[model samples]
Target: MTKSLEGRVALITGASRGLGREIAQRLAQDGASVALLDRKAHWAEDLVAEIESTGGKAVALGSDVSDRKALTAAFESAVSALGRLDIVVNNAMWTKYAAIEDIDEESLDRMLGVGVAGIIWGTQAAAAAMRQQGGGSIVNIASVSARLGLPQAMVYCGIKAAVEGMTRSAAIELAPAGIRVNAVAPSTVATEGVRAMLDEATFEARVASTPLGRLGATSDIAEAVLFFADPMRSGFVTGQSLLVDGGISVALR
Candidate 1:
């Protein structure tokens, strides 16, 4: 809350709810002007108001992250409203739980479009805008599914794994422009969407398996993102994927 990100402008996709919402608030608290981009134009209005109420700057725009043209326009709109772009958070994703054999073509395409293609499009848009202004930071929200093999999550796992791959490759490719690309892979967190997806027994089982005896909090993931976003902390770091899985990953290993 020291305004480390003062004067910086950040754009986050899927900014309506869950991790995206929390990350937006976190950045705003650090003095970064945030642009909330969600599929529905009005979805982030309340969030924009929330930030404004606290003396933070925010704008809400509607665009599907999977569409390059629309996404590019959204980036332009954010810059138009906020003056400049400094941080880009590619947190938009569409997911479906299915067994390997049950994964349908339509579902696979949707997942790939939002989860994988969205990253590429976001990186492209951010790189274009950041290149003009010298440099910026890109934080992709991956998942523990990328590192662990979870049942009934074949499509999700594959897409998240691609996120890690894209993060590294983009980091190397964009370094010369002074842009930094990194990934944050979170374990199961207590989000509305997650709670809705899981049943009581499964939720308790996850807690029992986790070494920390509790699920991750939105703040835990946001703090990790702050570490990467604050150039003072991670200016020299890029292409790294920080796993915020509450030590469950290690316990399983």
Candidate 2:
């Protein structure tokens, strides 16, 4: 760990567990103080404790990213606690696996609310904060589903695609302000949530489809996020969506 992100402050939504938790730990390991925000705020307590135990700075803030006002307040709270905001990872999302026709109105709204609206709100808050500080970075956790349409995942795919679109537009609009916007699109990762969604046979089939012969791990996505978060390494890179899918994004299925 080179402390490349030393003294930088990072705010990550859905930081209680899974990919968000991994991103938080990874950023903290690189020397950035992290603010973990989640709807279930208590879930982040253990992660915050773990980071602190490892001599890293972190705080757990219970806030729903879908709620613009609450999310804005959380962003301010993060800045208040960490002094300044340098990075924002809009990784929170609400999704349900269902066929297009089977999807209900509530599910559709929730997915868009957290997955799409949440990103917009988070970016707006982060961009404002970063402007005051001269510049900053914002990373959105997209998905390979955005590139490949899958059955029973239409809503998820649409929301992710929206995120990618937003990233590009925000990058262009925020660049002049020194705020960079980017996204990471990951394939199926072996997380509890993903495992629950896919059966063993389906998981095996997915692994076979990937060129690397294995499902992605949380650390894989976390590493890509680190690249975008570090200005020294990716200062000139923005509006780009890096795929961390173990080469699956390129395989001609």
Which has the greatest lDDT?
2
What shift in Å separates residue 212 of candidate 2 from its native position after superposition? 0.7
Give the alpha carbon lDDT tens digit for every residue of 1-253 in model 1.
Answer: 4689999999999999999999999999999999999999799999999999999999999998889899999999999999999999999988889888898999898889999989999999999999998999999999888989999998899889999999999999999999999999999999999899999999998888888889999999989898888898899999999999888888953
Candidate 2, residues 1-253, lDDT tens digits: the string is: 4689998999999999899999999999999999999997798999999999999999999988889999999999999999999999999988798976799999898999999999999999999899998999999999999999888998899999999999999999999999999999999999999899888999999999999999999999999999999999999999999999999989986
How well does model 2 score by local distance difference test? 0.94
Candidate 2 weakest ten by summed lDDT: 92-101
Kindly provide the TM-score of model 1 when superposed on the true structure, using C-alpha atoms. 0.98
Stretches of model 1 off by over 4 angstroms after superposition: none
Q: State in Å the error of residue 61, model 1.
A: 0.5
Q: Predicted candidate 1: what Cα RMSD to the true structure?
A: 1.1
